[model samples]
Each structure stands twice: as structure tokens, then as C-alpha cells.
Target: MQHRFEDKIIDTVIYTALLVLSLVSLYPFWNALVISLNSGADTSLGGVTVWPRAFTLDNYQVVLSDPRFFRALFMTVLRTVCGTAASIFFTALLAYGLSRKGTMGRKYYMLAAIFTMYFQGGLIPTYLWLRELGLFNNFWVLFVPWIISVWNMIVFRTFFQGLPEGLEESAKIDGCSFRIVLPLSGPVIATLSLFQAVLFWNEWFASGIYINDESLLPVQNYLMNMINSNSAQEMISQLSGVSGGVGDMVTRTITPKSLQMTALMVVSFPIMLVYPFVQKFFVKGVMVGSLKE
Candidate 1:
């Protein structure tokens, strides 16, 4: 009876603690959503809580009306898809080659690759190299330099090494090539590709530094610029019918903080939507190379 009582108390305490932590962690995002939904003028007056007191969709309308926003979104999506696919394919190919037993110079190649993880050419030299290649200010500049990742290579190699040799040998005996073996690594690929996708999606620094064309800027960099240099009036002008129309009334209600929160939601929503689908793969992929048969 005493043990049961103690367990119940512990469980209660743990549940309460978790509930408090969850609320604490989620409140800021919730507040941001509420503020984005509320009228910007009203949001500025403060004291708005759980729900919007003056709900309006003008902030999102203002954002969506901008052609640059669509271009940036498209650029970000393109970068994530192309970068993740290229990086994973090339990295996996290298990993597979290195994982093969008796590959010549494997040890030396691995050592050199690992060396890069600890050291990088300084920014000036890297910038000069990119310039010499005429890649600067190009759209591909956002992801070309990241086409290979040493850490991802290491993970891929480890997972590939743990794969049962008998599976490949059986496939080979039936006249199948090594390409058939790649399908067996679905978990690792899916997991790593998701990580790579997120990295590409959230990348802003490369776009900011290497891309000069506004059309080439990814959503993240555009969002950064909007937050840092944009004004409410400038954003208002981007909306149609702002000349003494409903948009004008909407424009009057917009504040920078409200616009910022709306932009944050727009930027974040896609990734949030994607995460759930790949979550199961993530769980399974993380356990790769953890055990051996």
C-alpha cells in the first residue's frame, strides 16, 4: 500500500511537471500566433493572451501578395530538394565505396576527409575559390559548396558497413548489381535526407553572402532582410487596393511586430507540416549501427 502510494505520488508529480514544462515551451509560439492573428494596432496595445482580441488576416494577405515572397519560397524549396538529393546521393556513393572491404587507399581517403571536419579553408580563400569558379552571385551558390558532408558520409559508411554481407551476395548471385543493394538502406537514407533537407531549408547565411539577386534569395534570408530593414508602410504598399480601399484600412492596423510574427508562421509552417511524415523514419534511422546480428 505504501509503495503504491509512493508510485502514485511520483507519477502525479512527474505529470504535473511535464504539463508545466509543455505550457512554458509552447506559450511563446502560441502568443506569436495570437499576435499574428490579432490586429497589429491592437497587438501593439499589449495584454493580448490565449486568443486574438481583434482577429484579422491582413498580415498574411500582405505577405502573400508580394511576388518576392513567392519567389523566395520557391527558391528555398528548390534548394532543399536539390541540395538534399545531391548531397545524399554523392555522400552515399562515397560511403558505399569506402565501406567496401579492401578498397585501395580507403584509410588514407578517410583520414583526409576526417581532417576537413576539424579544419576549413578560411572565408577569404573559400570566397576567392568560388569567385574563380564564377559561382558567386549564382543561384547554385546556395548549395553547391555543401554537396558533400563528411559527418553524413561517416554515418552512411557506418550504416552501410553494418548491413549484412549475405544480402548483397545473394542479390549478386541472382545477377543483380550493387545498385539493388541501395534499396536496403532506406531507413538511413530517409533519416539523413530529412536532416539534410532541414539544413538546406533553414540556411540563410550562404544566400545572404553569395546571392545578390533578390529573386535568388531563399525565404529565410528574405525573412531576415524583412525583419532587419523593412517598414510597415513599405510592406503595406506591396498589397493591392491599398489606395483608400479595404487594404488601406488593413494597412492602418499593421504593426511591424505583427507582420514579423505572421512571416515567422509562414516560413515555419512547411517544415512543421513535413516533420510528421518523416518522424517514424527518424526514430528507426537513429538506431542504425547500434546493434549487430
Candidate 2:
């Protein structure tokens, strides 16, 4: 009876601690949502609590109504889908091929891949190469240069290596080819696809660096530009509305905090929406791949 009571106490303590931690992790996301729905005036005064003081969709309306928002959103989706598909396809093929111990020059290919990971031609030369390829200002600019990641390749290779060699041998006995062996490896494929999808979705730096055209801007770059422009405009408007000659002070003060909160919400929403569906597959894949067989 005493031991049972002690276990109950321990369970309670653990649950309480986990609840607290979960709240702490979730607080920032909650705060951002509350702030975004809050009136600009309320936000400026830091009047927003857990719930918005003056609930309005004005900010979202303003953001969504902009043509650039739609353009960038579309471009981002395109990049994520196409880039992820191409990345997974090539990575999977290479990983499967490399997993075969008898493949010619496998050691050299692995060494070369690892070497490229540690060393690369600098930015200027890469840019020149892209330009030579006529990918500058092209939509392919987003997907072409990053069609395969070495790290992802290594993960996939390790996963494939973990699979039973007898499975392939059995399939060969049944008149099945490597292509047939692959479709049977669903969990690993799903896992790598999810990883690559997240990579493509989260990528903004590449778009910022490689894409100069406004039409090709990914969601992150678009949101960043929107935040900057909106903050500036809001500052100007607020300053003009205020009677005080302290225009510069007011402009400097209010914009950054509000914009920071808004940008956080904007950038995080897509990932939050996506995570639930992909998360289960992600966990399963990693577990299956991590096993040594």
C-alpha cells in the first residue's frame, strides 16, 4: 500500500512537471497569436493579455490582400513540393545504390560526397556557375542547386544499409528488380521524404540569395519584406497622427516590437499546420532507419 502511494505521488509529480514544460514551450506561440489579433493601439501599449483586448483580423486582411503575399505563397508551395520530390527521388536512388557493398567505386563515391560536405567553392564562384547555367532569375534556381543534400543522402544510405540484404536477394529470386525492392521500403522513404519536405519548406536563405525577381520570392522573403514595409508605414502613420514633436522617438519605439511579434506568427503558422500530419511518419521513419538490423 505504501509503495503504491509512493508511485502515485511520483506519477503526479512527473505529470505536473510535464504540464508546466508544455505550457512554457507553447506560451510564445499563444502570445504571438493573441498579439496578431490585437488592435495595433493595444499592442503598442502592451495591453494584450492571453486573449486579445480588441480582436480584429485587420492585420491578416492587410497582409492577405497584398498581391505579393499570394505570389510568394504560391512560389513557396511550388518550391517545397517540387524541390522535395526531386530531392527525395535522387537521394533515394543514390542511397540505395551506395548501400550495395559490391557497387563499383562505392568507397570513392562516399568519400567524394563526404568531402564536398566539408568543402565547397565560395559564394562568388557558385553564383557565377549558376549564372553560367542560365538559372539566374529562373524558377529552377530554387530547386536545381539543392536537388540532393549530402547529409540527407547519408541518412538514407544508413537506413538502406540497415535493411536486410536477404530481402533484396529474395526479391531477385522472385524475378524482382531493384526498382521493385524500393517500393517495399516505405517507412524509410516516407521518413526521408518528410525530412526533405521540411527542409524545402523551411528554406529561405537560398531564395533570398539566389532569387532576385519579386515573382519568385518564397514565403519567408515575402513575409520579411512585408514586415519591414508594414512597420515603416505604421511608424510613419503613427508619427503623423501624434501631436508630439517626438516623431523619431515614437517611430523608433513601436515598430520593432510589433513587427517582431507579427513576423514570428507569420513564419511559424505554416510549420505548425504541417507538423501534425508529418510528425507521426517522421518518428516512425527515424526509428526504423536508426535500427542496425
Candidate 3:
């Protein structure tokens, strides 16, 4: 009876703690949504909570109306899809090959891969290297530099090692090769895909460094440019009907900040929509992959 009572108290405390944590974590997203939905000018007045003080769709219209927004979105989606797919395919292939014992100098290659996780060439050197390779201002630049993630490689390799070797051996005995063997690594593949997708989706720094063409900018890079410089103001200036009025020192109420929030939502919404679908697969994959270790 005492133990039962203690468990109930513990459960209550945990639930309360979790609820508080959830709200704390969710607040930033809620605030962004509120700001995005509010009148651009009204948001300047501040004090927005979960609900918009003055609801308006102008911010969305302003951001969506811009052609560059669509282009950036397209580039972001393309980079994520292509990068994730390629990384999963190639990384899994590498992991599988490395998982097998006696793969000839595998230790040296693995050591080299691990070495990179601890060190990277500074920006200028990397930039010069990209320049020499003619990857500057190139779409291919996004893929090549990030083609392999050493940390992810290690995780995948560990998971692959945990998997049974008999599956591959049986298939090989029947004249099948790794192509057949690779697809069977379902949990690890799903797990790696989620990680790689998120990594590729959030890419901005490399784009800024390698891409000089404005049209090729990924969505996050575009957003970062808007956030840090006059680009957001310039973009906002391009927005029509941002007119706000007053007889006594009237000024435009909508600021670039609101537009920034709107722009933020434009890129984030797709990811939010996508996460639900992949979440179960991702969780299952992670659990199974981690089971052995």
C-alpha cells in the first residue's frame, strides 16, 4: 500500500514536470506562429502570446508573393531530398562494406574518417579548394562537401556490425550481392535517413560559402541573409499594401521582423509537416539499432 502510494506520487510529479517542460520547449514555436499570423505593424507593438493580437494574413502573402521564396524553397527541398538519398545510399554501402571483417586496410580508412571528425580546414582554405575545383557558385557544391558525415558513418557502422552476417552470406551463396543485402538493413537505413535528412534540411553555411548565385540559395541561407542584413527590409519594401495609417504621425506598422517570422514559417512548416510521418519509423529504427549497444 505504501509503495503504491509512492508510485502514484512519483507519477504525478513526473507528469507535472513533463508538462512544464513541454510548454517551455513549445513556446518559441508558438511565439513564432503568433508573430507570423499577427498584423506586421501590430507585432511591433509586441506582447503577443499564443494568440495574435491583431490577426492578419499579410505576412504570409508578402513572403509567398516573392518569387525568390519559391526558388529558395525548391532548392532547399531539392538539396535535402538529393543529399539525404545519396548519403543514405552511399553511407549505408560504406557501412555495410566496412562492417564485414577482413576488408583490407579498413582500419586505415576508418581511422582517416574518424580523424576528420576532430579536424576541419578553416574557411578560407576550404573556400580556395572549392574555388579550384570550380564548385564555387555550383549546385554540386552542396553535395560534395557534405557527402559523408563521419559521426553518422560511425553510428551506421556500429549498427551494421550488430546486425547478423548470415543474411548477407546466404544471399551471396545464392549469387546475390550487397545490392540485395543493403535493402534488408531496414532499421539502420530508416535511422540514418532521419539523421541525414535533418542535417541536409538545415544546411545553410555551406550554401552561403559555395553558392554566389542568389537563385541557388537554400531556404535557410535565404532566411539568414534576410535576418542579418538589409535584404529583409528590401524584400519587405517590395511587399505591396503594407500601408498603415494615422492622422497623428502615422507610420507603417509592419516591420521587417514580422516578415522575417513569416519567412521563417515558410521554411519550417514543411519540416514540421514531414516530422510526424517519419517519427515512428525513426524512433523504431533508433531503438532497434541501439538495442545491441
What does candidate 2 score in Cα RMSD to the true structure? 5.3
lDDT (Cα) of model 3:
0.79
User: Considering summed lDDT, which 10 consecutive residues are worst modelled in model 1?
Assistant: 237-246
Candidate 2 displacement at residue 42 in angstroms? 1.6
TM-score comparison, 2 vs 3, better candidate? 3
lDDT of 1 by residue, 161-226 (tens): 887788878887888736776787888888999899989999898778777888788999878987
Going through the candidates in the order shown, the clash numbers are: 0, 0, 3
TM-score of 3: 0.90
Candidate 2 per-residue lDDT, tens place, 1-293, comes to: 99999999999999999999999998888988888777655688865769988776555544544566678878878988898889988988898889888899999999999999999988989989988999888899988798988987887888778767788787778887576757766776777776777777777877788788989988788666656666436544655566654444344333444545665576667756766776767777777666574
Q: What tens-digit string does per-residue lDDT give for candidate 3 at 160-182?
A: 78767777677778888676666
TM-score of each: 0.91, 0.81, 0.90
**Candidate ordering by TM-score (highest first):** 1, 3, 2
Error of 2 at 79 (Å): 0.1
lDDT of 2: 0.74
Which pairs clash in the backbone of model 3? Answer: 40-254, 41-253, 41-254
lDDT of 1 at 200: 98
